[model samples]
Target: MGICDAPARAKVLNMSQHNGSFGCNYCKIYAPFNEDLKCRVFVPTSNLQPRTTDEWKKLALAASNTKITRANEREFLGVKGWNQLLRLPYIDIVSFCPPDYMHSQLLGTVRLLLAYWLGGRSQLFKYNFHMVWHLPQVVRQYGPLITNSAFQLENWMGKIAKQIHESKIHIAEQAINKCSVISSTITNFYSNIDCFETEFIKYF
Candidate 1:
């Protein structure tokens, strides 16, 4: 490399060298086999408040970080590209940000990704759809899109950042409800046991 410009693969560990790596030196970092990769999915459950540039940046960041984590998710889960998230009714792009500044960067980067996802990479290499006809052209539109709660941001997402948020309680409630069914059934059995015991006592 040049004296001024830094060399590629300059890290101490050279994460791109491992097998099963979708992460190439030129683009993706860290080998795909980096299995211990921790991932968190952050999707707002509701619409957001009015955004300043800063707030909008945070919104975008969540999605940006999610995209990176998704690579790991795809590898570990054996899924295809990010299209799966698109199909989910309430799932949005996700990311992990322990600190706020890191959060903001994700937002900023997501804004960049949204642009790329739209606009056809370069105009010469456009993403085209030859489907039902007139609607297909309209359906494929992309660009700045609303970052709604993962449950909300479905179907075609176009335009720039739209306020997307999510309900953690709703998700929690569903989780609780899902698991509690068995617990509730077990509880009922115990509760009815007391009644049965009293009836047997009376009979005896």
Candidate 2:
């Protein structure tokens, strides 16, 4: 197979540098696995059993009406239902989503999620962005927690953000190299469908 058109298991094992426009360590493991041809696997459900008639009726009623909010956390479980409804027939939302919004939101989400999964916020890893983009917006959306981070503590960070704002091609490169929070943010981003989309889907 051609580059990035191989098996997931094999791609991950390669661990060598990826020859691409952007140098991503994770892509060395993931890019090749994504041939952009194979379909996503359907998830098996509840021992592959059917819901009883009343269960189906209850679900139908639940689906027709509801607005989700943080106050009504349980209702937002609807994201799983949305995922189930859309998983088939191809659900690649990447191209459909807004590039600027995604660019601004994705990096932060990925790092936050990783921090929670690996252990906690303190256990983040270092990454290397091309330069940076809408970090102020990300910090605003995620809360003030990032304000206390070592990555944001540098005196020159304001200048870096200015650079990102002025030159869209560049990004917050050094933040990832020295800060573990960036990695944690990445993992956190992919963990929850609802939380992620709710916080930043307008960009998409």
Candidate 3:
């Protein structure tokens, strides 16, 4: 149900229909519906399963450059039965194609800000600029729902950065470690607190 970027939709569409020759698992057409509309679902000719990295890369490329005339349907179709690649019913694919708020809102905003500040700078700035891509993985590891943009880990990172700034820490790793220690201490403190203490603390 969660999609990271526009490429995800493309991948889904590609899987649904390999080029224009094959039918889609979710929709009848090769193209996706409008942003406000939803695509129709249909039982796939084959079963779904995990694909190799090369296959996924090809699919991604196909999705991005849709004009490429290629009939690689055999590569995507399963041996038999409905594909279980996503483990979701065919009907749910359209509803699940919702825009990813974390990418569209939080990450997009941060990326724009970074670009404005360091558009054409040194290699270090370029590296720092691309570091935003790692954020989603780090956030997912912490067990937060990726779909809910409001609960993004970037907010917490912002707070940590603010603390780092206030502390005048020259080293990034030390600041990150400080934030980790602070978070663990707070979590441990709460874990031992009684319900009454929790309520009292909430009022403050």
Candidate 4:
């Protein structure tokens, strides 16, 4: 599962960013930026439908086939082009890749919601608040928390960085070797965990 920020997710999926008209990954709604409120607001419609993996692939493929300078513009949908990740049959490009909760919620959604409640734009606050309610639907569809988070990824990255003793030379090789060693250590520990538990019980 690819857990990243909205912008990073967009880059990975080869789609438009969050601020774009068709930016929402889950909803196929055209959210235009309201200059007065300074944010993209979704217009509620009876026929609003959730984005499906099959639909996404078709749109993405069509966008890529356009072969224009601005292919994303050519396509009404926000899809830019085909991504290498699409080759994996198991990974549903729509559902598998979820934005990290911390960045998408705490720093993004919650922050904006708070701003609305704090009385910046009193007249349009209610309308904007209702528009932002699509988040709950997203959570229900994708789940509240993903398998991975930014913190966990950052920690792993730090460990990998520390494993490299040299500055620039053979860094990739060193990282791979270090990761292999770590993986083996973890495997061995897990393989012998039952034996260790039995020994502990016998001795104690």
- List candidate 1 segments past 4 Å from native: 1-10, 17-109, 122-204
After the best TM-score superposition of candidate 4, give how far the Cα of residue 112 lies from its true spot, in angstroms.
Answer: 2.5
TM-score of 1: 0.14
Model 2: ten consecutive residues of lowest lDDT: 1-10
lDDT for residue 87 in candidate 3, whole number 0-100: 48
lDDT of 4 at 85: 81
> Model 2: how far is 139 from its true place, Å?
30
How do all the candidates rank in terms of TM-score, highest first? 4, 3, 2, 1
Candidate 1, which ten residues in sequence have the lowest lDDT sum?
124-133
What shift in Å separates residue 45 of candidate 1 from its native position after superposition? 23
In angstroms, give how far residue 204 of model 2 lies from its true place. Answer: 35
Model 3's TM-score against the true structure: 0.26
Candidate 3 vs 4: which has more TM-score = 4
Best by the TM-score measure = 4
Q: Quote the lDDT for 48 in model 2.
A: 26
lDDT tens per residue, model 3, 34-129 = 233233222232343323333444454555444333454444331112223334334343334333456644565456576567874322222122
Q: What overall lDDT, based on C-alpha atoms, would model 1 receive against the true structure? A: 0.27
Q: Write the per-residue lDDT of candidate 4 for residues 1-204, one digit (tens) a residue.
A: 677777888899998887777776766777767788687766667676677788888877888778535444735478888888888888778755565666765666566667668966443322223334454554555443432336545555666677888666687788677888667554654445445455545754
Off by over 4 Å in 4: 44-47, 67-75, 116-146, 165-168, 180-204
Candidate 3: minimum summed lDDT over ten consecutive residues — where? 122-131
Q: After superposition, how far is residue 44 of candidate 1 from its true place, in Å?
A: 21
lDDT string, candidate 1, 1-204, tens digits: 100011112221122211222222122222222233332112222232221223223433444445535435433221122232233344322211011111222333344456677974422111011001122222122111111111121211211112222556564555455555445544654455456555545754
